[model samples]
Target: MTDLQIGNHLRKLRFLKGEMTQAQLSKNVGVTRQTIVALETSRYAPSLELAMKLACVFDCGVDDLFFWINLEDAKSKYSSDGQ
Candidate 1:
């Protein structure tokens, strides 16, 4: 199976927003600072509600923040059938 991963641009967005701090963003999103850190580091994935809150904070859509990375090879060698 492909090792799909979720990536985000939270750190960049925060910096773009006048160097917004993790603590401030956490407070605005009602999450712990550690949660913000985790999100920025791609160590944790946010819930849909949290994602929406973040999008609202930056006035951007969720697609602007998060993206998917498919870690599978071109031929999908990990799969039984490389279709």
Candidate 2:
């Protein structure tokens, strides 16, 4: 299975939730701003806990906010049944 990057959706979700900044979301989600930026740019793929926190902030599900956008093809391969 291919490893998928979910960064682009993170940024979209952040903006859709109100153009929130990486720093603000990072603080809310208890991660570094650099981490948030990384998540937004495909430099990082968040762990399950971090992904859940982000979903919570966006008032959405983990899959809703991160698993099926940006790199949907890559994500689809790994999101189900833990691959």
Candidate 3:
């Protein structure tokens, strides 16, 4: 499994926007409710298209919803070679 960690701030935004249901958001984004659940739980990483769709739904930038943890970098023993 990938060690990357992604945040689902969209869920918070959706909640703020009249407590929107995942099903509704899913329909707007052309995805299944389970996809929304996975996204909210950070168990799945959406594609660029899905990310953009979600951003549109939340009325926010993709960066505002998802972020990379860079776990490998955090545990790196040596500086990266500029190869």
TM-score (C-alpha, index-matched) for candidate 3 = 0.76
Candidate 3 lDDT by residue in tens digits, 1-83: 65668877867888898999999989999999999999988889999999998889888899988988766775563455533
Give the TM-score of each candidate.
Answer: 0.83, 0.70, 0.76
* lDDT of model number 3: 0.86
Ranking by lDDT: 1, 3, 2
Instruction: Residues 1-83, candidate 2: write the lDDT tens digits.
Output: 55444544777777777888888998998999999877777778788998888888888888877653445665676788585
- Which of candidates 1 and 3 reaches a greater TM-score? 1
Q: What C-alpha lDDT values do all the predictions have? A: 0.90, 0.77, 0.86
Give the clash total for candidate 3. 0
**Regions more than 4 Å wrong, model 2:** 1-4, 68-83
Q: Can you tell me which runs of candidate 1 are displaced by over 4 Å?
A: 73-83
Off by over 4 Å in 3: 1-3, 70-83
Better of 1 and 2 by lDDT: 1
What is the C-alpha lDDT profile of model 1 across 11-70, one tens digit per residue? 999999999999999999999999999998778989999999999999999999998877
Clash numbers, per candidate: 0, 0, 0
How well does candidate 1 match the true structure in TM-score terms? 0.83
